[model samples]
Target: MFNGLSVTEHREGDDLLTAGLGLGGLQSMAPPAFADATAPTAPELRRRAIWSNWRGIADLSPGGGYGSVYGSVANVPGREFSALARLEGARYPHRVLVQVPDAFDHDRRCVVVAPASGSRGVHGAIAVAGAWGLPRGCAVAYTDKGAGTDYFDLDAGQGVSLDGRTAAATAAELAFAPDAPTGSAGVRGVAVKHAHSGDNPEADWGRHVRQAAQFALQALDEAVPQAAPFTFDNTRVIAVGISNGGGAVLRAAELEGDWLDAVVAGEPSIHAGATSLYDYATQAALLMPCALLDASLGPLPQPPHAAQSVPQWTARCASLAAAGLVEGADTATRAASALAQLRATGWTDAALRAGALSVGFDLWRAVSVTYASAYGRYGVGAHPCGFGFAALDPRMAPRAATPAERAAWWSDGSGIPPGAGVGIVDPLMAGPDAIPTDPTFPGLVCLRDLAKGNGGDALRVRAGIEELRAAPPREGLPVVVVHGRDDGLIPLALSSAPYVAMARQAGRDVRFWQVGPAQHFDAFLALPDYGARYVPLLPYVHAALDRVEAYLDGTGTLPANAVIEATPRANGQALEAANLALPR
Candidate 1:
């Protein structure tokens, strides 16, 4: 919510500001600017906490997870800045040395530092970067919890154990339970941990998940207290997160209530119960086994001569239905429709054998292995990216198949019909399956109980946001959400849809910014030295940060563009280039 700072207003022409690094400290450069006014050298820039080497950065969100290296920054005398990062932690990992103002703290009010989720033990470098840029004076503080050992899996086989969802890193296991500490003026921050693994049974996973959430909340309590010295009453805390860590912010508020004032979730994955969004018929007619070919086999395989000897795969739905695992008229019809579609779609023993054996005699065998391992019950049809129907059908060529093709593939009443719903599915599985539909796609809909479930905390976040808008201001909790238009992992539409609706419905003050051409990780991992032609990430960050400050001060308005542009740079000089637009 800090909106006081401006790149153009402060920096003179031709000066590069301190840009953050990307995954593994990958370096990129912003274009040379033509503006004016030099900041004073050694202009009494105040020093805050020190950030050392950030090891494997855990870039997590509700949708999925990735890792990165840390970027380092020292305060510059003037209001300009520079920094660098390594792409994938390669030896020389793109060291960035940039400059920014020492007074650049967001809102110049308070700085509350939060840790990346699931990064309790790992160094700061492993944590995902914050969604909004930090203002002068405000800096995130990091702690070292030793690694090489799985923190969440500590009591994996022993029994269900719980960690406090305390962001302050100072709550008692039971006391903090599941929320970020509340009532603070300084910047509010939290340390997040990944929720229970897939192996954890859905039945009794809440206790452990709550414990982890409790830890995150406790961190908030420890990091920024409400007392006089801490002055949490003065500054607003920005909730920055990715993957499961992002979910943690929502969970903490859900369980603890009124903890985190504002939040930004990346690749957010909210869970769905029992059924899926895609109907059984749709899966059969459109979701072919061949679709899994590339992700499983690296490339397509050929057919074998004695294909009958090769095994054929029926989706888990068919098997479950036959074995009485799935019952009821709706489910049975769905299953039967899918099976018939598979058979008619040429998912025969011969096709399987051929694709399996094209490479070698054991090619078919390899295919079967992939079927069970990769496309089995647990991991199938979850992400939109992996969803069989969403893939571009090469046969269709340049343009995707029209409604006619879909009609041909779709069976009347047998499959999903026209508007079957595939509820939300698993995080990694949702991308492949997420597709826009008239009445919305019928597929797996994942809905987690925020503080209790393994993931999908976004839905639970509604209550907290509502409560905040109704309540008086504890501090200026400015919230700015940035998402990539073409993020393959987690579509930007999903992230912004609920958020925008919520803001409008509640009439609350929040800002939403969408970056174009930028995919999931690409948007966050931009630097200033890659070159002029490359895209500039700082502008996006700056814009959002400025908005955050302004909103807190009640002086700024959200920008009106699908993708906000930064100062122009030549293609040759740009380090990373991508333009994203907002969804209609």
Candidate 2:
């Protein structure tokens, strides 16, 4: 089932949870250094990736409980087994890693299946699952769910090894080696698996999770022959995750029940009801800049640079008016019209206000563009909108990635380009940035048009969107879900609330907890206004896992489904346990 599998042990301060950075290193904004910057070893890449992914996914603020509350980056001695595991006939390999801690109990065998959040690398869940499971002596199984950070630079003839090594494009069985064009310009751009693999990988997230769990049991048995016969019957297998990882475990539960005992999903980016991310994200990409201008929203959180973008947003409003997407005689009226459109499209009042964070960070454009390719199954450089990814020169034009950039692709990339220095290429938007007239506008229009399902790209994207909604988990699987009420990315109304209702109606055991004043990005909580206005959801994620485990262990009953009404740590005040209002 596995190819080129290898095992190695790590101990003595170089641990599983923090990769030897300890709490201090993770807190630092700068990345860990490779002794050889141009060519990082597989282990070095792994450590830096862990640090990058942990900071990307979780809030590590001193006030938000880095050292005091739950984060303990102490040395966790363990053996790690990793390899390129593939689905039947799959063109791309999904990477899975199983970490077996030395403290794992032969009798109290447990395995935690944690798929990566979003399109992150296999370490994406290091913050949520690794931090929680490694200390409890549970062997943690992690998969990128077929979408990983194995990037390809067609211009440089370079791609990445599954072990995080830089390799030639022709190397066999690299995680994602796309078909390079004969003429360099034919494919002279960066390629990302999630957007360019033509796999529509989201369709197989459940199977990927199942594969990780299977590998976990096998690896655990091999790591400790004394526990050579571990199986689901004897060992407790729980699935825990957040964001896309959260959606994956829920999908796994639906695909199979017996192997998965219980599920704890936090702010899952699921499609259960009337809305899908592509539908809303594309809309937000077009409308949010103008929508944020609504006077009712007042002075919400925004970076200092957001003020500079006001001219771009004003230009966006004028362009929308010209295109008839909104109606107005002036910017303020057009902004109000944009706000109404958001409400009409199912965005709630809370989400509208909280969306300022994503808007400020320019996430709406990044997400809409990435998912458009995934859902439409568009291959590298084939985006109907003429969107492409490449490393930018000082001139901001596309250029080949540097050797140092290639070395860190696996460690620093978010499994999507237009990041880690690979910016998006839009043919219609001139100067890329020097012109600076809302360069995202043209690409966003193309994505929004594709959402309408008239052309071939639109039809393909809609079909893929249909495949995203997995049925509620089968009866007998107990589920505990925790969602932040104000989540703008995957709003509660669009995702969790409807899924919970459907799951209960289907007779599946499910408990839902809604935490107010909590938004989607826990990592964003470390930001200035964000720290003041939002509480971290990771603590509640751990809490939900605890409830599900206690119920599974017969030590306690499942917490009743209820609203948490969590308090925000406003005005620079430090966060407290009371802020969570965790279900007891």
Candidate 3:
């Protein structure tokens, strides 16, 4: 048993004697540590015990956001900080950090912060805890959703290498077999592996996120008693997150709403398949051809699709154009000419005759232009597929020029196809060798379906507000959703707007606020001397948190749902006012 060991024994700088104890060993040691320690109270002992367990597994030094503006609140006076504590997650142990201000209101109010997707785990949540939690005198807990370096191998299986002739042959075959199952003929599963074994098959990404939130809340409950000098009010717990984290909080609310007082999401990545028409159109135009080629040729090739016969290629392009999804006369002309050439000769002959790869790049540009023009007309943002797709393709990682090349190549209209009234093509052609043309298209569609439980996995993870309205309601819990009107990464219309409407229609207490002139990652840009900065949205986030805290405290009225024109100030703060022109 873990006797005589106090939880507070391992302070901020203290080293543990039993650092080698793995998760299993640690679990075997001692009871709950709720018993009184020889040196101090039982709560203090429990805190130290938990800290030791956490530090033994992961680094808790304030390195991630410590030097950045987001961690600036660490300098605030009268704030007590705790080293990250390891908590039991759904499948494995995860990390959590707690912060309590000296002037804590003793109201038992706590805030749980989640990070954005692709973030370096708990590091992503540190700033929010500092900026939004400390100043408000609320206890804060930050948790990583198993995306940290310790939980996932960043470098493992992240490359596409075809060395042997057999492997190369399999790659070539897979390239053409669109319906081929993932993990077949060396196809890699894009889903990153968890740190621990025995993963629950039923737990999709959303379920994992919900479980992480639950663990954090449980850790806070245990840590509060030990943090006696700085009391924490845990009764009013609010979950807040941005981007992927935003979606997580929504799911957490849906799964554990009874325990939460409020939920706040900013530019949440939700409703996966709910992309705009323009997004689907552009993605189809760019990826369909690449997918076709990639399937025919391995990751690297001298000439691809030379032997393959793609008789339906032209027909597909024609279909899109006919559907009015493709715009611009120049683009239409190019599509037509490309189709005509395909009909005259097979994909191989046409490719060799016209430099197929370059032609594909040209088609990408033309289609992208049409998509962009349509985006502006429709007032929707471009799908964030460029980044998402790059992450999926390991080749893009080694080739630094790949991402820039993709952006520039698609934007510049150099390789337009010449012809008249070209017919459109269907990106998702169905059956064998079907082209996946959507931004949300999973390369290993079959694998995704198997892992996610169905084709609606992405939507399920997003936990869209509209979808939530149809679920069993969590009575009395209010939700405040904030979005940046200028966020091209996750457009407001496709994400938060629909949820707000759904909640209102369901008679749920939901408020939506759109912040203009602010884009995703605005808060990160707030850091002084941060290179390549954009408009900072930290001011708006802070304001939103303030409003949420007020609502929780029953001391202020919720602002009417509307758009706020946010103007960035010279001092890095944003000036926000109600925009009457925007529809509520």
Best by TM-score: 2
lDDT of each: 0.28, 0.84, 0.38
TM-score: model 1 vs. ground truth: 0.38
Give the worst 10-residue stretch by lDDT in candidate 2: 431-440
Q: Write the per-residue lDDT of candidate 1 for residues 1-584, one digit (tens) a residue.
A: 11111121123322112223332222222211212111111111101001111222221211111221112232123332111111221111111111223343434434322333322221222223322233344433212111101111111111101110111223212111112223233211111111111121111112222332223233333333442233334445444444333433333323333334455544332222111111211232132332322232233222222253222223433333443433334433544454354445334322322223222232121122112112122222222222221213233111222332222111111111111111111123324543322111222222212212334333322222222221111233345556545333333443444555554455545456655444433322322211221232233443454555565567865544355443323333322222312222
TM-score of each: 0.38, 0.97, 0.49
Rank the candidate models, highest lDDT first.
2, 3, 1
lDDT string for model 2 (60-132, tens) is 8778865566555667888899987888856788999999999987767889899999899999998889888
Q: Which candidate leads in lDDT?
A: 2
**The 10-residue segment with the lowest total lDDT in model 1:** 43-52
lDDT of 1 at 421: 15
Question: What C-alpha root-mean-square deviation, in Å, does candidate 1 show against the real structure?
Answer: 19.4
